[model samples]
Target: MAEAGWYPDPAGGEGYRYWDGDRWSAQTQLRPGGTSAAPGAGHDPSTPIVVKGSSDDDEDEPRAGLWSQVKGPVVIIAIVLVTIIALIWALMQLGVLGNRGPGPSNPTEFCPAVTDGNYSVDPHPRDGRVYGGELSYPQLGAPWSAPTVDGRVPFGRDVQTQTITIEQNYRPGQNWVASVLVGELIDGDGFQSPEAGMDMVARCIVGAFYGDSPVQREDVTRRPMVVDGREAFMLEMHLSFDVRGLQAKGETAIIIIVNTSGSKNSIYYASIPDNAQQYLPTARDLVNQLRVGG
Candidate 1:
């Protein structure tokens, strides 16, 4: 054979052995710079030897290289997973993904001492058809005078002229009282517009108050106001009437005309005495709270 080939020792020892073409021989040597000697005598028995092709150092080098190659990707994947979990937890805590607590609210403060419980929903005692749900009136113990009825039957003369009347202290022998009158009347077939219907209501009211006395109409002012989210016409006028043979200065009358609750085109009339000026703001606020449907 060409020279004695280097081969692993056949005795399962850790060293290169000089092998003739067919077999391992006793001529052996250590790798790199170690001395060469007979196979059984070359190295001390306790000395470590490295096999030519299969060493612990060779296996450890490949494993360390593999870890270095994949280290960045593995760390990136772990960070992304942690961030997603944190975001989901934060959203759940903020109630964006679940039911949490109430946000905020507002309270009605019309009068200084008024609250929602101070008002009561009162339907008409006699006529069940007429409904004024939740009439926001002053409580019985309040400072202002409680409402009452005038001498006249609150309901008007015809089926077309049903009325609901409220007044402030019409005592046993009082000369005058502040009043509020809400009336529903039929719309005339010939009355083509709201202006015409308003004119007719004005004529009727003036006739009732004037009653053959020499009447003086002063400052007949008309303006637009809102009632229950609908547009209403407010007509304010001052008149002097004959009472018990003496010319008495009547309270300034403010009449608000709007569409009726039940009728398609009929008029709903609301009148307030200007003498109740102190209570006007409170009254307007209370009317704003009126909801039509029961």
Candidate 2:
């Protein structure tokens, strides 16, 4: 209907007419001067259609149009979506979306060497209610000391006092471990196996209490020394109903629960296998070994 102003795109699809703001331009022409000869005449189909240059005065140009049909709203939307994803990634690197509780992760590099000696123990407080015998991992000789301390685990303050004790004594039952092999703990509740994906750091120990006969492996994932001949692992989970974190009441704390199967029973991870390793020592002392009131 109106004049245009751009050039023709050979690769553009059929009827892919673009506005140059002045006239029509086509790549493969059916006739000379880009005009079809009424289609009835016995005409040559492969006639070359030569395009003439615009004879407008070089100095005299037309005004800009209302809107560009080429770069439409859909193109704009795609660009916006890409921009949003980029921004989210940048924010995570800046620690903006970081809500993980203050604690260091397990020192994966530190492998507790295996030897032949006493190795099973559970370091939880006196649970008078539940009745269960102690578990014992056969034996791993002299406990493996971290040859070189890479980076220590981290922990939070104030939140460490009472909860860390529970995290330090958690153990995984054999069934739980076996279940984890099949499914995943996607919902943060051990989708397939309860032990595979426990509810919290505290539950990690409690669930392993009576289950898993003939304790097979030592809880040396990130366990620390409890007694002279035992290795232990303690973990603190940041639990809330939903949303991956504790929101209201600002209750950002960890439950330090530990458990082990050994010669006697009971184990304590001197430090917790927590992201919040910094605050674990204090939490361990207050919750497990502390003496209150003078």
Candidate 3:
């Protein structure tokens, strides 16, 4: 029999287990590199001595260390953390999370404060000459009367169908009208180019004129062009709407924004209702004849 001390685990796990004279103890420790006989080999014991089997080459072989045991779990944890961080960054970019700053200011908000000396309130001429500031266009005869300040917004003067009347609660498309606005672009307009500014202004007009009404716009197109040798942009669209107490179902709208002298811009807006579709050709002719200067 062999007297026992610490020996290779009888269970074949990678360590040493404590052994008493009668049986193996529960205590354990790291295995030293080789397999050896039990301590005090010639003593008497109740149980047969057990020896672990190993080759001569295994004497110098390294055991699996702590890093090897935890490597897989560490790599898995790192991958999960990276995925979570990437997801958060994507959400922030899409404005689903994190702070998103305010959008562009509506250009029409600056119109009321514009006080240019070149602007005047005058009745437009009937003999093909209609003037608003430095801008002018030919008049559409009969039902399309002279331009007036009665239904004018701070942004411009307008000409309307003769059948329509201006009232205290007048909406823009309520009576189909063509407006010509000429003024200097103010500081807070929130746009640096005529194209971008005109697009914003067109959206504002839709909101103001057809408040709370379901409006569908179709055949919308825009292009850059030269008007009286000045840079200009034109946006045209067909608006169909269903509003309470309004007889017209839809209208064709055209908006032209021209960058004139210095910081000034000229705008021409026209809307012809579906009920009076016959006048659309006349409106087009008027736009074709626009003149920017003397």
Candidate 1 vs 3: which has more lDDT: 3
- Error (Å) of candidate 3 at residue 33 is 42
Q: After superposition, how far is residue 139 of candidate 2 from its true place, in Å?
A: 11
- Writing each residue's lDDT as its tens digit, candidate 1 over 1-294 gives 535456666687876775545555644556522223334445433345566767787898899999999999999999999999999887765434543211111111211222332133334444232233212222222333344322231112111112222342343443344344333333444334434455445545555544454444453676765556554555666655444533234545555555434332223333344444564454444334433333
lDDT of each residue in 1-294, candidate 2, tens digit only: 544322244466443333333433433332233232222143332344433534343223332232454458869889999999899877765434455421222222222222221121224234221111221111111222211111111110111111222222133321110000000011222223223222233333222321222211122223233422333333433322211221221112222222222221221222233344454444334334311111
**Where does model 1 exceed 4 Å of error?**
1-175, 190-193, 245-247, 261-291
Candidate 3 deviation (Cα RMSD): 10.8
C-alpha RMSD for every candidate? 22.1, 20.8, 10.8
Model 1 clashes, total count = 1
TM-score of 3: 0.51
* Model 3 alpha-carbon miss at residue 274, Å: 1.4
Model 2 stretches with alpha carbons more than 4 Å out: 1-53, 56-67, 73-78, 90-294
Among the numbered candidates, top lDDT falls to: 3
Q: Name the top TM-score candidate.
A: 3
TM-score of every candidate? 0.38, 0.21, 0.51
lDDT of 3 at 54: 55
